[model samples]
Target: MKPKKKSLSDLGGIMYSTDPSFVYEEENEIPEQALPNQQQDLRVMLDKKNRGGKAVTLVTGFRGSDEALEKLGKMLKTKCGVGGAAKDGEVMIQGDFRDKVVDLLQKEGFKVKKSGG
Candidate 1:
């Protein structure tokens, strides 16, 4: 099977007549002083979900990309010698690693706060 050919205007004319660099220029114009502090900006939560009769700990409230979360997750897992995954901006460790995670984030200069039971 093959897809049909369409012009730049086919997608609601978003791609056509729009200078791609326009957005980039606007984004790059923001000064560093305008950016929020990392310590006060991020939120950490522990969510428990019942999957297949097993409880899973979901650590969320990160304000970065998948790459950042993945890197942090890898480091945390390696440091703790455990298993986990970084998905959708959340880090899921196989066990209760809240304290360990907080410590690691603190060491990395992140302002972290534990929320929820």
Candidate 2:
């Protein structure tokens, strides 16, 4: 029987392998089923709360990332020339822009859902 290969520790206790095909580590890959849950996407919703008597459109269902909401808020504010804010994974635009916002978000390939009274 042949002797087993021994690994060597280089400087500062770093390990090295003579084999070129050896990989020390691999990336953390997420499962396919968890992809949707882990997706950094957003879903839009219409909200009607104490919006200072103004009709506010609420965008929600974001997968934990606020980047899209922030960007969308900016775009909507600029496009509609209205004011809006992104908070708690949701964006609130100051107006009843459900139809227009839905169209814009759909055009950008986002699954938007409107909800309100």
Error of 1 at 101 (Å): 1.0
Instruction: Candidate 1: count the clashes.
Output: 0
Off by over 4 Å in 2: 1-45
lDDT of 1 by residue, 28-70 (tens): 2322232222643445555556645443445665655456668
For every model shown, what is its TM-score relative to the native structure? 0.58, 0.57
Candidate of highest lDDT: 2
Steric clash pairs (candidate 2): none
Q: Which pairs of residues collide in model 1? A: none
Q: Worst ten-residue run, lDDT, model 2?
A: 31-40
Per-residue lDDT, model 1, residue 66, is 53
Clash totals in order: 0, 0
Please list the Cα RMSD from the true structure of every candidate, rounded to 1 decimal place: 9.4, 14.7
The CA lDDT at 44 in model 2 is 54
